[model samples]
Target: MPKSAVVLLNRPSLEAPPHVEGAAEFELLDVDAPHVRVLDLGVTRGDGVFETISFGAGHPQALAAHLARLAKSARALDLPEPDADAWERAVLAAASAIDPAPEAYVKTVMTRGLEGDGRPTGWAYASAAPDHSRARSEGIRVVLLDRGYRHDVAKTSPWLLAGSKTLSYAVNRAVLREAARRDADDVVFVSSDGYLLEGSTSNLLLRFGDTLVTPGLDQGILAGTTQGDLFAFARSQGLETEYARLETRKLAEADAAWLVSSVRHAAPIRRVDGVDRAVDTDFTAAVNSHLIGRTS
Candidate 1:
């Protein structure tokens, strides 16, 4: 199996091996070093916060936004406040070490350290991004899956970590697996009452003529960095945007839809639940050009 090239942070003594073949370009740095202990809560109970960022030509685009989101996630978990300065330095170091590839992903993770320890274990690394050409250009088939929660669960059930992007993704992964079993490429998670929520790993966006629609942050969806950024970009281009309670049936009524993320950027959805829709090439290109191309 091919492995992604990685660059370790805060561990100077470790040595990274050479890169292995993979879907996208990457460079390795310090692959053999172990950075965490078995007793850490992050590993033991999936108690941690994370952010995935996209870097191109050695520069991290939207890095500040990602770090801000990471801090919010940490706060939601009541973990120790992250040292943003330190994380920024580490991310830059990793990015500097990576040989320039078309693009790569840098994921920063901060776990509540050992169960009894107040210190948090935080580190970051740079790796190759997964190839999303097919999904981006050819489009993807998605299935709607029930998230088994009410849209307002985030407000009523804070313990659910509703809007936080934590390391606990067992349920999210399971939903994607189910989507695969249904012969779909991705998922759009809907709430129990039939409101569209988000994707297992990405945020959902729908196009209705000149408008871009997404489930509101109040609906318990992880406040998506890419989605928010794209909305801003779209509005700058004179496109109207909205945040509303989307029904499952709304998928078939849209001009187009997409699953957006940091690493993958914006992937157009060609079909939803086996129903085909016309791919809006102009809309996709405009949105992606801003979302993926704007690296500064």
Candidate 2:
């Protein structure tokens, strides 16, 4: 089975099939078939947390960072803490099952389990990543959509799970769909107060003159692993970096901006709100090299 296939894993019977005993073609399952009860909050109420780690060179890049975020997300949901050792084993097994040639998206999802049982339903697996070569090379068109929340919402509403990367992604997907209706490839979400937040699935980054700026974490944005890594790399390269609140109008004055994430990496935003922005391929190349390092 290809890694991309959804293999059911039953937590009760944690047994690997014979074909999965050794190296298999894209291992998608490590245990028996799994079936979630219809009443499970994870599905019915979208009560869960997840992390997507970039799998390459036989292991996940930024494994520690991803796991840390997963733990934080789980805590935010009041779900059971993640078993790092077990997750480590599952992730390694899944990554090893993939064909060695292709880069993969390895995800770990933990839900609040059944409505009453209280046991968390967690699994880690690898899958083929959707190709973003065109967007990476040619750049992407984006539109700004109001996130419909104030920047201070996180501080005032704990139940909202503001900074948590929860599984409740319906709104995010809907926003992206709306962006598509506007003939845009992606979306940059801004707060109701006109402060830049983040993308539907990525962290927003801007290059303002010689300085790099990203929205401050206090604004209720999911902490982006990719953005954190890139910022460290940028500083090492002697670029000035700042984490401050930004207005959507900053997009117009930016030398360049991108929606950076673990899977898509760094993709330039050529057009914002149907208006063309700057594109610096050389800068993108340099940053990508720093982001992924020279893998030989």
Candidate 3:
């Protein structure tokens, strides 16, 4: 089997017409081949939605939640609703085609196809995940940057697509570069109005005594699938969970913190703007163990 695999969906959305009149639901393709068109809106305008699902021992973690989020992102972009069953099958197929590993990820993307084509392009690409042991164990240094939006941006200006996980992530990538310039590893975006938002590509999680708090969804942050699972796990372990509007100062005051996401799982925040912070080593280990052992 190849180290990586790709499955191109013929009909990403049942609401829209198929790519071909009569073709298979999807096709396994060469990972190195060019599949997208130059004029595709997803290529030219970054008009699309995506979800990256991590697989543990070949079982895709939080598969249902990821698909639901993908559909939600599609709705936010006014794109056709993704066919969950089809996407699930495609993801599984791609996952199976790749070499078995302790950790792997399958990324599903649905794009607004060529202008006026009225058809969308969708595919799932699977590959073994990168080694995140160093960051997960030693933790990461984070810097707070201004996201240039208000906490109420999602409600006030939904057109900005604040909470949607779209293909346009230039700003997200730029934040990491800025963090690098500041001698940090990652970023936590603060709203222009002085509210803590989220990480560049993950959700902000903080520990306050025995409670785990994260910025509320209303703050224009993506509803993190990994964070959701972590919340459930925390509850099972007798930790209280909350979603609230957090101020920038809250990050510094927290007992321990992390930036949680799918591929990276939970990376504890050990430093902020060069200042050291405490890390809950025991809890972090337990969190990662549960994440890596998930079968559903």
Best by TM-score: 3
Say which candidate scores most in lDDT.
3
Runs with alpha carbons beyond 4 Å of true place in candidate 3: none
**Order of models, best TM-score first:** 3, 1, 2
User: Which candidate, 2 or 3, would have the higher lDDT against the true structure?
Assistant: 3
- Computed on alpha carbons, the lDDT of every model, listed in order, comes to 0.79, 0.77, 0.96
The residue-by-residue lDDT of candidate 2 on 1-296, one tens digit each, is 45553332233112212223344322355444665567778889999998988865555778888888998988887776776665766676666666663467777887776776745676676777787778877899999888889998888887899989999999989988899999999999989999999998999999987788999999899999989888888888789989999987888888999899988888999998988878978878777666655231
Model 1 residue 134 lDDT score = 75
Clashing pairs in 2: 8-34, 9-34, 10-33
Q: Model 3: per-residue lDDT, tens digit, 110-223? A: 999998888899999999999998889999999999999999999999999999999999999999999999999999999999999999999999999999999999989999
Model 1, span 61-143: residue lDDT tens? 88888888888888899876666765777777666665667778778887776776555666677777777777888898999
Clash pairs, model 3 backbone:
none
Instruction: List the candidates' TM-scores in order.
Output: 0.90, 0.89, 0.99
Residue 234 lDDT in candidate 3: 99
